[model samples]
Target: MVSLLKNRVNIASGTPSRIKKLIDIEALVLSRLAVILLDIHPDVKGYSLFTLPQVRDEFWDLYKNYFHQRLLEGDLRICLYGPLPSGNEFKGKKST
Candidate 1:
């Protein structure tokens, strides 16, 4: 996913895709953690992500560090929403 972020730092250079990953990508670190701990992507309970009583409690710090690093290095964009307003025209999977 780091590669995805690297390739999308610029909004003007991108094309529309099947996945709408802007807002949800904000909490991407949690999804990474969830995948590590539960083999899932949902947070389960991200309310206290910073003060978790579990082994993955450090994940929040890691996420924050990576985010800041990306910002400082200009590897990610502050305007992650890009040229669109976002989520208003979502093309999510059909309800089955």
Candidate 2:
């Protein structure tokens, strides 16, 4: 199977190399996001995020906080999203 990306550049429009790089990177990020979000209710447009037993909003707050902290800590950043009761609280941290 071959992607239309050809050898990294568009075979027709001839997309700029820099733009292609940006798109490739974004695609990688989004693919990871999709995998994480699969644990969600499967209806979120672009959200997964929950901490306290299906509490969608709370989950996102913790997720973002942890995400930034991980970034600051120079750790690989990825938010875990799920709908299980265990989502209620991880590490004693609850939604604000």
Candidate 3:
């Protein structure tokens, strides 16, 4: 997701903070989930498939909390699209 981060960094360049903490947190969570899934279930594919929505929700919450204001439509759209496996739609899914 380097490209996503690059785009975000470029967009947020004019903002006060040099680093995007929310983006970083989202990336870290995704990476850690990926590594764990891969290691524990080497034969299992599409494991990363399940965590996408959680990641999106987490990012959204972070953005809302950190910014303490509603994101513009365009910014919200960008944040939504940056995460992988588009249209995560986790509603009604069972949790372990």
RMSD per prediction, one decimal? Answer: 16.0, 14.1, 11.9
Q: lDDT: which candidate is best?
A: 2
Write candidate 2's Cα lDDT for 2-91 as tens digits.
774454432211112332354456643322222122244434353233432444553454346434455555553444355555443455
- Model 1 accuracy (lDDT, Cα): 0.33
| Poorly placed runs, candidate 1 (over 4 Å) | 1-46, 77-96
Q: Which window of ten consecutive residues has the lowest lDDT sum in model 2?
A: 10-19
Model 3 agreement with the true structure over 1-96: per-residue lDDT tens digits: 878666423222211121245246453332122111111111144434235455435434544654333233222322221234444444566654
Ranking by TM-score: 3, 2, 1
Q: Candidate 1's residue-wise lDDT over 19-70, tens digit each?
A: 1233246523322221111112224463222223342344444436444566
Runs of candidate 2 with Cα error greater than 4 angstroms are 1-38, 41-54, 79-96
Instruction: Please report, as a residue range, the 10-residue window in candidate 3 with the lowest summed lDDT.
Output: 34-43
- Model 3 steric clash pairs: none
Error of 3 at 24 (Å): 9.7
lDDT, residue 94, model 2: 56
